[model samples]
Target: MSRAGRLGVGIIGAGKVGPVIGAALAGAGHALTGITAGVDEERVQAILPGIPVLDALEVVRRSELVVVAVPRDELPGLVTGLAEVGAWQPGQLVLHTDASFGTGVLAPAAASGAIPLAVHPAIAFTGTSMDLRQLSNAYAAVTAPAAVLPIAQALAVELGCEPVVIAESDRLAYAEAIAISTEFSRSIVAQAAELLRGAGVPHPGSYLSALVHSTVDHALSQAGSAGAGPPAEALEG
Candidate 1:
């Protein structure tokens, strides 16, 4: 599907993930009708004005698509509660950002007979409005039933992201990989910044960022070589 007829999405949590991504999706042509919130009033009000703010159940009832972007520990209960409230309509798309598991975590909603899909962006979030722009090119992992693979993939494309299909069983592994990647980046940057400080650099963040860019490039290049041969040789290259 092209960008023109983007789907209307209802976000059930306006905390860190929902409001930001919903705003970005709205910018990308998807109709973001309403957002649900339980966070700081001043914060939520500042970010999402004019748009209808509803209770979580009301959000699930009003929209064709439901996005559960709440905290990990809270997801199961929130989803179960939504199911209990008879909120999901059949064929309504229920999506989540929980990467640690695939659509399997959505079994409850699915049993409610809703079309369950899970979308997870690979980029780290800063929980800022500016971060909305970054969604334009970030990567997303998608898991959905085969019948509506296109819809799920199209949702990722709607955000201007390349969609990677994560197998139902592999979602946890992919999430763990993201955690590793982030921690490794932090550790390496920390060490590099310390070395730069030793060198009396006035501003180390820029240098550290550049170094990270180069390192990531080199690693990706090495990875592209199926015949990269040996770890030592690839590193030396």
Candidate 2:
């Protein structure tokens, strides 16, 4: 596809990540051809009101850019299944949002002439419009071959993310680090909220939300200034 043109995009999953990212790409002028969601139809529709909801094969056949946002474990099977059915088209762009596996997992589709890309946004998604604003400050870990790296980066930028190239060999370790930090942060916030509620504070979670946001923003700013150095304290348990 030409750099100036918008591709016809289809989403293979309508879970938390898919609809939001599909919406972001739609906002970037891409035509949202269809989306597939087995259980979260209502939530998906709420996130992508006018987009058509179709089956996975139909989605793949109709789109120039197919985004596979299923869970990490299901990704490889889905890609291979699609390839086996000859769903992937020549010069098609295939992207996945899973942080654990890079484009290597999309080898089945790539062998069929699809351009595989792994572009993961390093932010928690709420499957709501609120997530859109979060995209501006979020960083996306992008893994693609050198020849198509610019295309991945461009898509990330269009979605309001700063794209960082992640080596395929380092993808799993990178995902683990993100999981450790984000999951631990959530646990800490939940514990704090529980303690506040025990002390007779109503809406403890609501009260703690702003403080957590501010603290995280400050920490990220500090980390950026420190040039990606390891944190003084380990977050992992």
Candidate 3:
């Protein structure tokens, strides 16, 4: 970490989420030391142009903050494997972006004196620059040891996101909610688009885009209000 509090950040994956996140942190003045390309060389170049592509262990060894943005299944093994190799450094901040887990999966790294954190940005990623813009509108679910909880929240803020504290125990519930919403919305959109196409609409997705956005926005705006939805009669019709 620099005296200015900007970290030398390294990323473990260059998949859909990693490079975009590195770009976000870079935007906040953190130095992106390196990233693992993982077959996403094109994406890494596109989003984080000029960042060095290094292996996972090299990335961890080189940085004060390491961001692990691999798939959920891969995270535990990767962290443990890194620990087994003695790659984790004392006082280093190690964070993973998987919504399904909190800091628990990072126990191995923590054992090596690493400070573990979990910060999941609540949005679908396209592995593109558009994700950087979306970060401003998204909330990040942050889980970390209470002593360093603010660090996790600050990192989320640095990514242009509002930070919401999520308890370690509730990480799975949070993941479930995210999964349900995204899957349901995607299924609905696909069905709607199919129906529209069947009805001879030339561009079903484009036609429904505005309507879907407005409807979801309205629903979310009304989400916190009790009895805020349509009346029984409205549903019946």
Over the stretch 1-237, how does candidate 1's per-residue lDDT look in tens digits? 555666778988777778777776777777877887666656655666567888888788778888889888888888888788787788788989877867887888899888888888877776677666677767788888889877888787776677778778887788888889888888878888889899999789887777679988898688768653234223212
Q: What TM-score does candidate 3 get on C-alpha atoms?
A: 0.93
Candidate 3 residue runs with Cα over 4 Å from true position: 1-3, 227-237
Q: What is the lDDT, from 0 to 100, of the residue 11 in candidate 2?
A: 96
Instruction: Say which candidate scores most in TM-score.
Output: 3
lDDT of 1 at 148: 83
* Cα lDDT tens digits for candidate 3, 44-97: 898898999899999999999999999989999999999999999999999999
Clashes per prediction? 0, 0, 0
**Better model by TM-score: candidate 1 vs candidate 3:** 3
Model 1 clashes, total count: 0
**Distance from true location, Cα of 146 in model 2, Å:** 0.5
- lDDT, candidate 2, equals 0.89
The alpha-carbon RMSD values of the candidates against the true structure, listed in the order shown, are: 5.6, 4.5, 6.2
